[model samples]
Every structure is written in structure tokens, then in C-alpha cells.
Target chain A: MSNKAKHWEKTKGQMIITMILWFFFGYVIFMFGENINSASFLGYPLAYYMCAQGSIIAFVVILFWSAGRQEKIDEEFGFTEKEDD
Target chain B: MFKGKFIDNLPKIYGTYTGGFLVFIILMAIAESAGMTKETIGILFVAFTVCIYAFIGWLSRTVQVDAYYVAGRQVPTVFNGMATAADWMSGASFVAMAGGIYFGGYTYMAFLVGWTGGYILVSSLLAPYLRKFGCYTVPDFIGTRYGGNFARFCAVCVLTLASFTYVTAQINATGTIAARALQIPFELGVWVGLISILLCSMLGGMRAVTWTQVAQYIVLIIAYLIPIFWISNKGGYGLFPHLMLGEEVARLGELEAQFGLVKNSAAAVKEAGVPGGLKSISLPHSEVPAGGMAAWKFISLALCMMVGTASLPHILMRYFTTPSVKAARKSVCWSLFFIALLYTSAPMLATLSKLSLMDPTLPTGIIGKEISAVMAIDWVSAWTAQKQAFIADFNGDGILQLNEWFMRGDVVVLSTPEIAGLPYVISGLVAAGGMAAAMSTADGLILAIANALSHDIYFKIIDPKADVRKRLIVARSLLVVIGAFGAYIASMRITGILGAVAWAFDFAMSGLFFPLVLGVWWKRATRQGAIAGMITGLGSGTAYLIYVYPKFMGNPAWLGIDHLRFGIIGASVCLIVMVVVSLMTPAPDSATQKMIDEVRIPSGKTILGKQH
Candidate 1:
């Protein structure tokens, strides 16, 4: 029961976040296709940076966020079997 | 940190270094034959690979049979992640992907989406269910879940078809790498690939494959990165610094006065044989419409890869090898992380090369350009005299334009290092890495096919009385046959490595992806539904590829559309069929429902079961 709860807690949030990010990414792609490079986030061409670098950064961020959250959930629910911490 | 593990395993690990020397000798002879002088580099790489493999072997040897198959239901997040990376890299991802980007341009990013998105289905939908069932193979899951021999047979057929198609592509890739790097004939290169795959995989079974793959993950990544670094430096982009902001982009924008500052900063992509000279920036699709696919086509291609990756039997089997649902998910993340490193570089390299290639005075590495060109034309004419050959005189002029040269997509990485005039050593290492990727995946897929035939089909259905030991023998025998058949298929197929590989993805996406995903995740999924889905999806995808694709592309009625697009259409059909049939058929029984619930159970339940 606890295991299911933990998974639901972690996965539900992740699913929502992932879907939102996916849509956001699609919009960015559409924006680039539209040839609209808005003002810079960090002095870089917003469209150019988003297409090339931004997607990768977002991917890494989501990966860490999801992995870390699951780990925490696993710990709270006593699901982990590994030694050490 | 390494002291306890190092001291305990020093003698055995040192013993494994002997095989390292053997691999070194094999590589050295090839390098020497190719006039490559990279002895130290080759030796170092071989040593690194052997050591990692030795470590994995040691780790697995400590586990029991159940653990050997699924890590004893105790794998942690990080280790599973590493193994997942190894599984995902295979030969195609490791070697051919960069080549696609290098040769195909921004359009090729579709492969990345196709490959990665497939995993979304795998992890979010199929993986946990498979884990709950505790089945070793896709066929095992189908047979157990559906409670029928016919379902198992269908699964075996799907597995065999997908694995065989995937393996042949790997063989072709291995042959290409070996022929180019080893300077041997294509036939001999295929033999080398066959021998290497058989020897590496035959020894310790899946145990050996997993360990070797983990080791290969490290070797291929390092090999992949070195060439990129060399090219970046040669083109005036320092490692980490320029990756953030490309120097080649700036250089191209500066060199082309029409584009002004953008000329030195923006990369210029030029066709090989175009005579009008370098364009400032990739002119809009209006100028190079043939060069880019429509956005709809691009999206479809990406969807194919995404769906295809999830469906591939070999990749799915790796998840079954992990201990728990959580471990499987963790592994997916790690695989993505590892793959992302290469995936990101592929586009960067392609863009940079485009910029560099635009320079009118760019070095071609030909000793004498005029003499070489005349000699090459004569060589082509002589070859054509002996046999029919196709050559397009694009510019009304009779002469073959220097820029008109289209490098085969498979040769992108090989030519990239050479294009930049990087040291011969880096080029040789890249070739070895490509070979490693191809060989490792080939071995795994061959093993999967063997298992599908012997364990899933022969022993389970045709001759249920066969003992475990006898089945093992059959499996080994089948491996040899499959390996030989792959070599024969590879010899007959003339399509280049990455192009052929995309077709393998299409087969998986259309034939297996939907069935696997829906069978596991959807309660209403039924045996009849799965069978119909697989057959129709695969049939439609294959027919479309063989017939409709060519027509859509406005080609002669035989030449197919790009295989990736077929994958998207195939996957969708399978998904639609599965849903429609599931609604019509009865839902799974109580036992199956329990199994599904078990898989979806949180990690907490897994630990609780351990306590019991």
C-alpha cells in the first residue's frame, strides 16, 4: 500500500510536469519555426539557444528532478534496499 | 574508495588484462595494415575496456541464478542506470548516430526524438508491468500474462522478426567499421564482426553480454568524444568553451562578406557537388527543398524512433534483467543521460562541419586536387566501362563538380576526423569504437533470437519434454545459425549502416511497440487484441515501406520512403488496433489482474515482500 502511494506521489507529479514541458517545448519549436527570436534569457538568441542548447538543459533538469523525487519517495516509504544512506 | 574492491579482486582482474592484450594485438595489426600509427592510444583503450568488462564479470559472478538474470531484486538506482546506458548505446546509437548528424544536417535530429521518445512508452507504460511478472523475455511475459501458447508464439514471432532485423543492421555497421578501420575487404570485415560477436557473447551468456556492454558504454563514449574534440579544436573551437558558443559559426559568418558578421559566426552548410560555391547560411528550404523534409515528415520520423526504441526486444530484455520496477525506471534515466552526451554532440558536429565546408579555400586533404579529380573521373569511367554505374552531372557542365561530392552518411564520423586533418590515431580509435558498438549489439540481438527460437519456441511448445540443459544447447546452436544468417543478410543489403538501421527501428515501432505498451499498461488488453495489433501494424508498416512510401516520395514505385516515417505510421496502427480489439475482447482474468497490480505496486511493497 505504501509502495503504491509513494509511486503515485512521485509519478503523478512527474507525469504532469513532463506533459507541461513537452507542450512548452512544442511551443518553442513552433516559435522558432515562426522565426520569432524573442529577447535573450542570458544574452543569447532565445530561439537559437532554445532549439540547440535549451532542450538539452531542460532534459537534464527534468531527469534530475524526477530521479531525485523518486529517490526521496522511495526513502520515505522504505522501498529502497541499497546499503549506505 | 577503490581499495577494498581493488585488493579483493586484483588477481582475477589482472588475469582479464590478458584478453586486453589479445584485443590490442587484433587492433594493432589492423592499424598497422591501414598505415595507422596509434599503437599507444589503441593499447590504452583496449586496456580500459577489458578492465571494465572484468569488473562487470566479477560483480555478476557474485550473484545467484535469479540475481544473474535480474540482479536478485535488489539493484539500486545508480548501478541500474549504468547498465541501462550500456543497453541503450548498442551499436547504432554509439557509432552511427553522430554520422547521421554529420552527414544529414539539422533534419537528422528527428532520429534523436524517435529513439528517446520510444523509451517514454517503455518506462511509463510497459516496464513496470514486465517487472511485476518477473519474466525473462518479452515472449515469457506474453505467454504468462495471456495464459496461452498461441500468444507466446505470436510474441516469439515478433521478437524474432524485430531482433533479426536489428541484428543484421548491426552486422552491416560492424562490417563497415571493420573494413574502413582495418583496411580489409568487406567480406573479411563481416567475418571479423561474426567472430568477435560469437566469442564475446558465447562465453558467459547474458552475464558476459551485460558486463561487456557496460564496459563498451565507457569505451564508445570516450571514443565518440575524442573525435568531436579534435574537430572542434582544428576548427578553432576549444573543448568546453566553444561548445557553449561555436568558433566555427563565428568563422563562417566572418569569411562570407554577404552575411557580414553573421558570415563568420553562423555555420555554412554546403552540398558536396554544388558548383555555385558556398552559401552564407543554409538557404531556406525554398532553396534546398530536397535537402529538408516537411515538418510533418520530421515529426513522424521522430515519433517512429520514439516508438521503435520502446518496442525493440533486445532493449526491452535489458529492463527484464534489472531487479525491480524502480530499478528499471532508474536505468532509463541513466540511458538517456549517457545517450544525450552523444546525441547533443551529433548536431553540433554537423553544424560545425557545414560551416567549415563552406570555406572556398577549405583544405580537401587531397595531395594534388586537380590531378586527383582527373584521376577519380577516369577511375569512375573505367569502372563504369566494366559495370554500369550511376553519376549525375548536376551542373550542365560535363565536369564533376568538386562540391558535388556526396559522402555516404555512414562515413560521416570516419570522414569528419579526416576532414579536419586530425591525427590518424583519433580516426583509428573512432573506427574501433564503431566496431565495438556494432559487435556488442550484434551479439546481444543474436542471443535474443537464439533464445526466442530455442527457449521460447522449440522447448516451450514443440518439445515440452526438453530439459533445461538440452534447451541451453539448442540456444547455443541457434546462436551460431543466427549469427551466420545475419552475415549473409548483411552481405546482400547495399543500404548504408544508419539508413538500414532506421528500418530496424520502423519494424520495432510498428510491430511490437503498441502491443508491448498496451499489453502491459491497459487492463482490457487481450491476446486476440495483441495478435491482431502486431500482425496488422507490422504488415501495414512493411507494405507502406515497400510500396506506398516510394509513391509518396514521387519516386519509381519500388524505392521506399525513408524508413523512419513508416515507423510512426506503423506504431499508430498497432496502437489503434490494440485499443479497438481490447474493447471488443474480454478483459484479462483475476490472475492477470493480480500480476498487473503487483507490477504497479510501489517499491515499498517490494521491500515488504523481502521482509516476508
Candidate 2:
């Protein structure tokens, strides 16, 4: 495959991982939140903290990690944007 | 000392801006004690902040298309993130999300999840490619990618519909906040807020909107945080509230048990608002589906909002303003960081605010108090006079039931400072912050639609050769017309801000999500397929919304998907349709296929656009 194909594959593979994480935190945890609420964390229901606070914190980490990793991939494939306009 | 570029100056400028704003707030607090009326302080807070935005707008005004449309494609990553955060957080997020949590409980967390999660999709699948595509507007991408005016026109239609719905909600919020502060009629407040937004954005287009939004973000974050920190300290949560919010939630849960306050039940009549005139009379956090439907509702709304975030024109437009595609991707991280500062605190704010109100130890506590005495309390009487809180002696027992003392969700944050017995200046400050949130979002939404109308519909389709001056003039004129139309709808009190925001997301998600995503990722997507996809997704989604809505058909939702989540059905149908049609139809030309391949790469000139 061409470099273009490789770049696209690397990006798509990263995205698939992202979507899985997004699904797990965004839906799976919340879907079973009732059961999760049976457990407590830091004096609050576990599911509630996950949804209201922990999940948002996770989203930030996910985006930043993906961005750093993608930048590395861009460097590997020489796809980084030129500095000068 | 600072001879560098704008990016180099941002921290210093923003630091000074923050310090100066703090000094001004302190001055106003002093003035408040010096017999400056509450109304005067409120007016000063709004007028002063708006003037600052207007100054920034004036400084940034331009006739160049790139500057007007994409801020000369030079916004730094961090500032773009700040601006995007401001633009994304409308009146709904500032004034209503905590209120939504106060009312909706766990299910309401969907807004936090969906709104933030959508950025994941933006970073991974959309923003980078769209930036590389190098279009001025979202419809520009559609028009060029699909190779026709028809596809662009359809995209424009969806963009306007979605954005217009959202703009109305912002206007509603602006009007309410303004009306209370300025002692003006609600109808008049709509125009006051609308005019401030216009003054901020009408002069400079995206350039002005971007800078002014950055400034607004500072004011809003400052405004949002002060009350939280104050209440946190007073409530014994100390300076770092998040560490102790779970304990507070446990306290609130205990209070709920003590008061028999179950979450998500249909509110009593008085609290629910007027009798069927606008469902808002008691617009709880959302149509949180009950029982087995709860999980589906959360997932569905979260999915709808996430897709909608990835697809919104105003949001996507922010990415185009960044200097590079990498900047576009990185900005999402910053955007989430800035936004998360507020979102993470929201549930805590909701918990702490609710705790203060329901603690039964406070003088304002009313759940079990006699209705007559609760009605006589200063804050209660004040809010009652404003009709924001209604205390009814429903049972003739003359006591306030948990359900009897009805409060508008919009009032939660607005009333928190008062409930906490802080200085009225904090209320004025919060008002300014809420206005900043509403105005910033309105500026972006109105500009998004106007850009679509003028850039896509007028220049692209009507007269491709219109001059720069002519194009800018046309865009500004359209902004006035659209702003006025949005204000008129808002004045009618159509629905609650949060509900309309949900509708806007659903509309955007239904019509634009699949087509835009496919245009970037799928080489086989044809013009015909794109057009078919937009129409079907939008059409089916809107039909379901109206069908499931109580005011309309009142039909039962399929698979527990409420009207608010109609985007799910629409997007699914659209994805299947677009793929099928692409396979059946003749393939797009080789150039188009190559363009698709090029969009995925990040290091070159935009295929469909000109570099400055």
C-alpha cells in the first residue's frame, strides 16, 4: 500500500480504538449504571461519579492521548503540516 | 517586551484581561455597598462587558474573505479551543445544565457525556480531514465534494434549520436574564441581548467572533467559578470542591430520603409551568424515559448530541480557522479541557446548590415549612414577584410540599448566589456571565447561518462573482434579518432552552452527520448518494420528532427513543441509504476520488480552496 493508504489505515485504526473507548464510557457504563450505583466511590454512587465527573475526565484524557499519538503518526508518515504558510 | 505574534501575546493579554475584569468586579462590589442599586450594577456589568466585546469586534473587522470567514486561518490552537469552548457552551450549558442536573438527576448526565463525547468523533473522524479539505463553510465541502449546487443547497437548509433552532434558545435565555436585570419586558430583553451579540460579531464576522468569544470565555469561566467556589467554601467543601462533591451528593441523597423527594417524577402542576401552553411550564431536565426506557434514553440522547456536535456548522467552522490541520485536532483537546472545567464542576455545583436550598437549617428552607411563611420570606417573595418561583397552598394544609414549591430550572444558577446570601454583586456578575455565554453562542450561531446564506447560497450559487465588499455586506445584512427572526421566535416563548437545544442537535445530526462523514471517509460516495442521504436523514428524523412529540401526534417512540433522540433513527437510516446508493450509483469521477484521498492527508494545500 502507498504511504497515503498507510496513513489512513493508521488513523482509522486509532479511531476504532477511540470509538470503542467512547462506547464503553459513553454508553456501556451508563447503561448498567443502575447496577453500578449499587457500589459507591468516595461516598457517592459509582455510576453517578462515572457519568457526571469520571467520564468527562476520561474524555479529556482520550482526546489528548489520541492527539499526541496521531501527531507521532503524522511525523512517522511525513504528513505534518509545513510551518510556513 | 512583546514583539512576537498574536499567539505569543495571548497569555499576557488574557492575563491582563482577567486581572482588569477582576478589579472591575471588585469596584462594582464596592459600588454596590456605596448605594449603587442592584439594577444599576446589573446594567453596568452587562454594558461594560459588551463594550469590551464590541471593542474587540471593532479591532478585528475586515473585508477580506479569509479573515471574515476563517480568521485568516491563523488562530492558534489554544485560543481556538477557548473560542470553541465559548461558542459550544450556549445559554443552555451555563444557565441550564446544572438546573437540568438539579431536576433530571443521573439521566441528565447525558448532556455532559454527549456534548463532550462528540468532540471525540470530531478529533478522530471529522476535524482533521475537513480542515485538509479547506472549505470556507460546511456546505462548501458538501457542494464541492458532491460536485453540485443541489447538494450544497440541501446542506445549507439543514444547517440553517439546526442553527436557527439553537439561536432561538440562546435568545430565550438572553431575554430572560436581560429582562430581570434591566427591568424591561421579556420581549424587549430579547432585542437587548440580540443587539449586543450583533454589535460583537456583525462588524468583523468570524475574526471578531473569535476574539470576542475568547474574551467572553474568560468572563464566563470567571463568572461560573466564583459562585461555585464561594458556595463550596461556605458549604464546608473547601477550595477544591470536586474532591468532596461525592460526599455532598451523599448528603443530598440523604436529604432526598428525608424529604421523600424522588427524582424524575412528573412535577406537580404549579411547578410544571402553564397549562399545556408551552411544555416548558415544567420542562424538567429532559424527557428522561422512565424504568426500562432510562438506559435507552441516556444512550440515545448521548448519541444524538455527540453526532450533532461533530456535525454542527458553527463548531466545524472553528476548525477551519486554525493555522493547520494538526492545530485543528489539538484544539479539540483544549476545547474539552476548557469546557470540562465547567462541566466537571456542574454536578458538584448542582449538588452543593441543592444542598444549600434543602438543608432545612437555612432560613430559606421551605420543603416542610408553612406555605404562608415560605411565601413571606424575602428571597421567596422576591422570586415569586418575578414569577420565577411559585408557592401554592394546594392542599389547604398551608404547608409547602416538596412538590408544591415550584421553581423554574433556569433560575437554579441565577438564584444560587441569592440563596447563599452572598452580595448582590455576585448575582450581577453571574448575570454578566450568563449573558456572555448566551451572547457568545448566539454570535457563532447567527454568523454560521448568515455565512451559509451569503457564502454558500448567495455567492456560491446565486452570483459566484460577487466582490469582497459586496459579499461582506450581504452577509452582514443577512445576519440582521436572521437575528431579528430568531429574536421574534424566542419572544414567543416557544419552548425551554434545553429542549430547543436538543432539537437543534437532533436536526443537525439527522441531516448532516452521515453525508459529511461519508464525504471525508468514503471514496465511493456520489453526489446523488449525498443528496439522497441528506433528504432522507433529515426527513425521517423530523417526522419521528413530530410523531413522538406530545403536542403533535403523541405517538409512542420506537425502541424507547424519544423525540429528542430522533437523530438516532435518522442517522442510521441515512448511513444505510448513503452506502447503498453509493454502491448502486455510478462512481464519482477519478478527480473526486483523488480529492477524497487527499483530504485524509494533513500536510498540503486544501484541494477545494485557496491559500491566503
- Best lDDT goes to which candidate? 2
All DockQ scores: 0.28, 0.64
iRMSD computed for candidate 2: 3.0
The 10 consecutive residues of candidate 2 chain B with the worst lDDT sum are: B277-286
| Per-residue accuracy of model 2 over B91-167 as CA lDDT, tens digit each | 99999988888877777888889999999999998998888888889999999999999999999999999999999
Over B1-612, each residue of candidate 1 has an lDDT whose tens digit, in order, gives 235654245345434644563466456546666775654554444334434555554554422333333434544455455456665666677665655554443455556655655555565556655765666667877776666788788778877877777788888877766665555687877876787677655545566666567556556666777677767666565655225444444444344343222221222222223222112232221111231234555555665666677777777777766656666766777766776776666656655555554454565322113433533653234423432222333343554333323334444565566557666566666766776677667867887778677766886688988765566567668888999999988878655555567777788778777677666557689888888888888888887777544434433332224544676667778888888987899888887776665655544343122211
Candidate 2 ranges with C-alpha deviation above 4 Å: B1-4, B262-291
Quality class of the docking in candidate 1, CAPRI style: acceptable
User: Largest DockQ belongs to which candidate?
Assistant: 2
Model 2 CAPRI quality: medium
Provide the DockQ value for model 1. Answer: 0.28
Per-model lDDT: 0.60, 0.86
